[model samples]
Target chain A: MSFLPQLAFVLILGVAGYILSKRIKFLRRNIFLGKAETRNDHTDDRWKTMALVAFGQQKMFKRIIPALLHLLIYVGFVVINLEVLEFILDGILGTHRLFAPFLGGVYTAAMNMFEFLAVAVLFSCVVFLTRRYVTKVERFQKPEMKGWPALDATLILVIEIILMIAVLTMNATDQILAERGADHYLALGPLFFSGLIRPLFEGMSLEALHFIERFAWWFHIVGILAFAVYVTYSKHLHIFLAFPNTWYSNLKPKGEMVNMPEVTNEVNMMLGIPTEAASNPSAEIGRFGAKDINDLSWINVMNAYSCTECGRCTSECPANLTGKKLSPRKIMMDVRDRAEEVGKSIDAGGPGLEDGKSLLGDYITKEELNACTSCNACVEACPVNIDPLSIILQMRRYVAMEESGTPAQWNAMFQNMETSFSPWKFSPSDRFNWAEKVKEEEM
Target chain B: MSENYKVPTMAEMAGKGETPEVLFWVGCAGSFDERYKAVTQAFVKILNKVGVSFAVLGPEEACTGDPARRAGNEFLFQMQAVANIQVMNGYEVKKVVTACPHCFNTIKNEYPALGGNYEVIHHSQFLQQLINEGKVTLKGGGEFKGKKITFHDSCYLGRANNVYEAPREVIKALDVELVEMKRCKTKGLCCGAGGAQMFKEPEPGKKDINVERTEEALATGATTIAVGCPFCLTMMTDGVKNKEREADVKVYDLAEMIAKDMGI
Candidate 1:
């Protein structure tokens, strides 16, 4: 009967691991739905970017208050995992404080550190909840964050708070049990925060205290495992994706848009320049730009998934600030939503990519694409280097080339450019007309 | 201006088997936009005064296809790019300098993929280099000494190419107090003219981006607002006009300020 608890623990671990691996496979398949593009150059730069931007949380410092608050939670999350490692081992072996006797004093010191971080994490989570609810930070209150996005953020914070409480309660009860000379409850020195809460449990029967301690331990471990699975479906995926996303970040000057080599080949043929052996003469020409999620590069799709819905991109977007439809945050969210929709359909063997919906028209609108100034503010503002502007431009290409849907003014400018080599219909021969003013001033 | 201040053309120079130190790519706005023509003239005067051999591409120069690319017409953009590359390569042009950030960015960054590569420099960076070389000198803070000026960063020149310091350096050389807007450098606001927005009316918005940006510049309380890119020159000039502060607040390109300071 004692081994039944170990069997249950093993079953739980097996189930959680299976679900997590399945979800990871789903994520990988969905991200690879995008077109292939090489992002593996500049190995040294990629590592440094991943280290500084993702690991160091460098860009978060752009806003000091949040950066400090976030750092506490981030450090706590990393440090407390060590305590979790002991919890896992104890649960699997049906032993208490598995590392306590092995390391002696070091175990007590580490417990104290974890306890302090737990309090810090608890405190930061409350402040974050307050920012999202009470004070209502502007970025978190955008139209794109109205429903699930807002709830997801709140849920994660609340979950962390409960998990921290569970940790402290378990520690406080275990301390009481140890003082009462109970078996399996080691008397590791007092943990500062948890010790303060030990008084409430002092009067309980040893059996009741043991029940609460075991319940809290199970609650904490199970909560952590559930969180690991839940993170894949939430914006909290940034905890993992930020590393790979930043590693493959665009390294060229911000102004340099990716060149379309296919367009280059076509233009070369039209200009009668000896082109590299033409793509099979009978092969069908591909669509000019992204009409659906798959038309974008894999990195762009990954960027969509990696977004943490922070709304930093939207807040910094000039188009959004000026009341245009182009919220870059919304663009990323739309891509991710469409990707999820198509990915699920493919999983169900439903008509995928032919479901009469597309990323351009159904998810994101032409108004949003048109409103972008191609300014890199949104790109600069993203903490993980998500390039919504690239997606915007690609969709704009679809509208212009596939549907001939550019605004009337742009088409006029295009005609002028073709006829006179300028956006205005001034003669090319008079290109140096401004120099006449120089001569006139000289006279 | 002296009669000796004649702008040479690449065609004429090439006919004589001569190559200038740099090819001055006078962009569409610098050629046709009436307000921006003054900027072109001022930069030319500075280049002439410095004795830098520079020639314009004249009729051979076409649009750099930046607008088409940003507007999402890749075919049109590459068509224009191929035509321009053929002409420049034909002339063996090696270096290019431009006063328009759009042209500078497109030629410097985008052209290499299409077989057109040249050492491209924005006029702001080029002017800064000239000042550092002592080829251009300010005489006792020539007309606007100790006056308050704010340098507006062009999105393409500053954020796009990371050339924030050069224009500011040139402005400080005028001995003017360079006050900065709340948004400057990497955080600089766009002038509502990039991405071919200059050719079309802005989408429905509560206010124009230029007005918002101009409000920030005016809040700095700088009397003179100096800019480097021609698109910025036109947008900010109109913005000052929109606020009806044209008389009290003047928007001048960096080259115009330097030319006035040198008495050229």
Candidate 2:
């Protein structure tokens, strides 16, 4: 009978791992679907950034209430998972409290800590749910968050609450078993948080308590596995991606934009400046800028995947604050959604399915993209260093170069810049007139 | 020409086989806009008073194409950038200073990638260094003393290049009260002239960003609204006009303010 339970646990673990790995693999491939560009400079800076931003949750601390609550759940998630190792071993060996003998009295201390975290996790989840549903935070209620985004956030919090409850109930039942001195039940001290709830089953028979304990164990482990699989598809992917995303963040000065080498080379050639031959001789002169996911840099796609949909970027955006349609959070979400659609189509059709729709027009309107001031506020506000401005600039480049659809006034400015080498209509020769005038004024 | 008032060009200086200490990049507004021309003259007067050997690029100077690049016309931007680069390189120019944040930003940050590298400094920063070095001294109690002066942070200067202190430091040197707008420094709002918006009409909105920013300045009860960039000077001045507070509030660049205080 013990052998059967162990075998079943092993089988379930196998299936969950397989499904989770498959989803991870799909996500990895989808992110790399964009064109390759290097963001690998400043290795030392990247490491420091990852440590500060992701591990330290430095940016999240800007809002203290949410930060403390998030830290509680985050610390609980990380530290409590260490206990999962013991659970895994106990499942495989058909034993209860397998680490108890090895740990001596420390086992009780460890269990106490885990129990505390479980309670904290449960508390944080409830507060998060209240903030989402009851408080109805403005960032969480934007139009882009109406459907799956809203449901996804609620579901994750619910899952966390359920998992925490299972942990507490399991401990409570195990304590009852230990008191009864039942077979395979070690008589350990009562856990701090769980001990309080242990009296609920005061009059239950040993057999009934044993059944309840077993059910609690199964529910906790199964729910965790399901959550593991579900999180790969949710914005909670930030739990894993945040580390890498923060590590690969742009480390240069915020004002400096990424220059397209192809455009640079073309300009160098046009100016009759002798340029080196093209690196990829076979590569044709392609469209000037990004029209879809594949045209964007891999880092941009990674940014999409790493989005927590927090809307902090949107809230901080001056354009969005001023009632423009350009929400930086929605820009990231649309990219992720488009990437998912393209990834799914490719998976279904052997990587050759042509989706006629694109990120522009069908999803993000030109008005939304044009409304951006390139202010770098979004980039600054992202808890994970996602550069929404880069994506905005790329799409604007497409509108300008491929579609020739810039506003008429902007086009006029461009024409003046080309002819007179200035945005003004005057000749370059007239530029010095102000200097002489300044001299004449001084005289 | 009077040695005290003459502004030499790169071509004139180069003809004498002499390179000035810095190249004064008189930007489009400082070179053309009538109001900004007074700002340019004030800055020039200060430079001359300080005996700094700075030469203007004059006709050789072209727009840095910051407006073009920001407007998503990369081709035009590059063409303009390359043309200016060629002129600067031909002049064998080294250090450059500009009173315009837009030009300062594009050259200091963007020009490097296109093979135009120089020790570029905004005029406010240069003026701060001059004051620190005691090159220019204020004539005591010159007009601005005991006046309520509030500084507007230019988007390119304050947020883009991290140049908040230099201008404020310059203002504080006049021994005048330097008040801050509610949204000053890093959290400063754009004066709405950035990103080529100065060259084009603003998109339809409930209120202009400059107007909103100007209201913040007005609420400070400042007699003088100090600025560092010519763009911010124009926008804030226009904002004051819109509120009919032009007589009550005057917008002056940091350079212009110092020149006035120096009795230039």
Candidate 3:
């Protein structure tokens, strides 16, 4: 019987691991579908950024209430998972409380800590779910968040609450079995949170208690494995991506835009200066900017995947506030959706690059791309450092260069800039005409 | 205009075998916009009164290509930037000062990567330094003493560059009660003229961003609205005009207010 249980545990764990690995591989391939760029500079700053932004949740504290509750769940989720190691060991060895003898007092202490965290996690999830459903935070109710995004957030919270409950139930039953002097059970002091609910299992027979304990144990591990797999498909992927995302976040002055080396080289050649060695000399130059996901840089694609869909960017966007079609959060979501669509199509033996539609017309509209002010508000407001403006600018570049779809007035100004080196339709010699006017005013 | 106050150009200064302490970058708006020309003159008067040796690029100075770049015309932007950079490099220009946030941002942040490096200072920061160094003195605040003056932050100058306090300190020196709009500093709203919006008509919308921002300024009940950027000056002026508040509320650049306070 023990052998059969061990075999079942191995098979289940193996299947979950295999499926999760496959999903992760698919996601990795999808994110790397874009052009390559190096983001590995500034090693010390990257580590510090990852620590403070992702690990320490530094940016989340800008709004204090949500930050506190999030911190509770974050700490609970990370710390409680430490108990999973013992579960795996118990399953594989068919031994109960496998670490009890070795850890002694430490085992009880750890159990107490885990129980406390489990209760906190459960409490935090309930509050989070209530906030999403009842309070309807304005950021959560935007038009883009009306359907699956809303359901995804609620579902994650429910899963967390269920997992925490399972943990507490397992602890509660384990305490009852200890009291009954069940075989292979050790007497440890009552776990802090589980001790309170242990009375519900009072006067239960040893067989009944063991059965309940075994069910809860198996359910907790299985639920965790399932949650692990579900995370890759959910916005909660931020849990894993946030570190690298924040690490690779733009560190330059907010006003300093990324200059295209191709443009620089062309300018240098036109100016009769020796051009720098081009990265891909023979590559097509007509595609000035991104029209599809593959045209974007790898970091841009990674940004799409790392988005938490929290709508904080949209909430802070001036364009969105002033009734423009542009929503920075929506830009990220659309990119991820397009990438996923492409990934699935390729997996289904369809031509990947031959997809009829693109991220430009299919997902985001020209009206939305043109509406951005490039003010960096959305960039500043993003807790995870997603650069929606970068994507917007790239699409705008496509519109301007490839399609020649810029507004007519902008074209006139571009002509002015080309001729007089100013946005005004005047000669460069008249640039200092105002200085003479200043003298006239003084007279 | 005093003929005694000679504004030397880089070419004229070079012909005389001289290099001034700074190159005054008079941007397109400062050079052409009728109302903003006063701001340019006011800033020049302050520099003259302070006895700072500065030369203007005059006709040789091109636009910093900020608008072109923001409008996604990279080829035009690079061409303009390279032309200006070449001219500046020819004169061996070491330091530059501009009253325009657009120019300041481009020169200070964007120019170096393309190989044009200079110690670029905005007029507000430079004026504050002049005041601190006992070069420019206010005549007992003159018309500005105890006046409720509110400052409108240009997005480029404030959020983009993290320059929040320098302009405020310049205003505080005039002994005026500097009030703040609801969205000031890092959270300040755009003046509806950034990102090349000044050159084109606004998108179809129920309200203008500048009108909304100006309403916030009007709500503060400030008698004078001080701006640091010429783009903000134009937008806020239009905004005030739109609300028919022109008779009650007036907008002036910080340099204008300072020049007035100093009786320059």
Highest-scoring model, TM-score: 1
lDDT of each: 0.90, 0.84, 0.86
lDDT of 1 at A414: 95
Error of 2 at B30 (Å): 2.3
lDDT of 1 at A101: 96
Predicted candidate 3 versus true structure: per-residue lDDT over B155-227, tens digit per residue: 8888788898999998998888999987788778888787787888776656777888899999998989999
Kept native contacts, as fractions per model, are: 0.68, 0.42, 0.54
All candidates: interface RMSD = 1.5, 1.9, 2.1
> lDDT at A249 for candidate 1?
95
Lowest summed lDDT window (length 10), candidate 2 chain B: B200-209
TM-score of each: 0.98, 0.94, 0.95
Off by over 4 Å in 3: A203-205, A276-283, A440-443, B1-4
Q: List the residue pairs that clash in candidate 3.
A: A442-B1, A443-B1
RMSD of each: 1.4, 2.5, 2.4
Which candidate ranks first by DockQ, i.e. highest? 1
Name the better of 2 and 3 by DockQ: 3
Residue pairs that clash (backbone atoms under 3 angstroms), model 1: none
